[model samples]
Target: MSLLESWDRGEHTAETLRGTTATYATYRKGSGPGVVVIHEIPGLTPDVIAFGEEVVAAGFTVVMPHLFGRPEAGLSPLAVAGAMRQVCVSREFTKLATGETSPVAGWLRSLARELHTELGGPGVGALGMCFTGGFALAMMVDESVAAPVLCQPSVPFVPGRRRGADLNLSPADLGVVRERAAAGCQVLGLQYAGDPLTGTRFDTLAGEIGDAFLRVDLPGRRHSTVTTHRQQEAVDRVLAFFTERLS
Candidate 1:
């Protein structure tokens, strides 16, 4: 059977949201405080959807956006290649660029604002993975995002210290993020301690945000902390963070 079958049709309510920067379809499920679960590279693979479902079950309304790649596509070399091509050429993402936030982050922050307005909670959570990892931090510039979870944020993609340590933020946006952190907005980060894709951004985050950044440096070099790799401890930590911050 195709891994796409993993998306249970009857469970999620699909809707399209048009933002200032972009328009995309979203799958929403559960009911409580809201959390925007951004997928990893290669699109919304079955693993990513499964993780969203798990987040839903943990008592929050989860919205999974179809960003790039074939929706419900499984992770294959071809699919990954195709997605990388799109990201590389698209202005919505900042692949090898430094000191600039991806343009798509504005759209995501709009989505979070709408969710928070609808749910009327303390705030909404933004969970970004892999290529979209630094997005959660960018979205934190908006007040709607109170809980930001960054899992293996690989961006400004290139070798060397400049690209490796870039936080994928412009100078102005980085100031806002620092203010948010200082104001007690806890940013959750989970990754394999030695994952090269994650680079030294974790160290950058620590230096920029200090004690406000909650660090979860797991063992080994496996990339995806909550989706493809799907660590139970990491998931638990994520859920606990959402509950503490958003609930």
Candidate 2:
């Protein structure tokens, strides 16, 4: 059997989330508070969906947006490369630039607002991984996004020292995010200490958000926290953060 076939599964329904400027196909499952799971550069693969299922099992509505790649495509080198190429040229993502939020973040914020309106909670949760990781922080400018989790956020490609610490947010957006953090909204971040792609963004987050940033820095070169690298402690921490914030 395929590795995906052996994992825990949940019933999910697919829907189109119509945003102000874009539309996304979203897979949703479970119930309670809403949590949007933004996949990495390679799209919404099986492992990403499995992580979403874990969120659902934790008693929250999990929405996985199909950013790129085949939804059920397992981890394949070719698939990852294709998705990376697409992201590199797509106007939606800010691939090799600093001090700018990706255009898709606005759409994600819209999705979160709509979900919060429909689900009726204190606010919604957002978890972004890899290329999309800092997006959750960008969404935090809006009060509707209460729980923001960034995992291995790599953007502007981390080619230099400045890009390494850039949060991929515009000045105005960063200012608002800082204000929100000061207002008592905590942000959770997870990453391996030795991952080059992540750079020193965690330090930037800590410096900007002060005590409101809770960082879980694992020791190693592993990248993906919930998959690939697969740190159970990180996964547990994420679940606990969600439960504490979303519940």
Candidate maximizing lDDT: 1
What C-alpha lDDT values do all the predictions have?
Answer: 0.87, 0.85
RMSD of each: 3.5, 3.8
Q: Compute the lDDT for candidate 2.
A: 0.85
Candidate 2 lDDT tens digits, 1-247: 5534443333322222223356667777779999999998688777887788788898998877777887687779989899988887777889878889888888788788888999987899999999899999988977889999999999878779999989999999999999998888999999999999999999998999899999999999989999777899999999999889877
Candidate 2: which stretches are off by over 4 Å? 1-20
Cα error, residue 47 of model 1, in Å, equals 0.4
Superposed Cα deviation of residue 132, candidate 1 (Å): 0.4
Q: lDDT tens string, model 1, 1-247?
A: 7544444332222222223345677778888999999998999898998898889899998888788898778889999999988888877788888999888888888788888999997999999999999999999999999999999999988587899999999999999999999999999999999898988999999999999999999999899999888899999999999999987
* Shift in Å, residue 109, candidate 1: 0.5
Task: Tell me the lDDT of candidate 1.
Answer: 0.87
List of clashing residue pairs for candidate 1: none
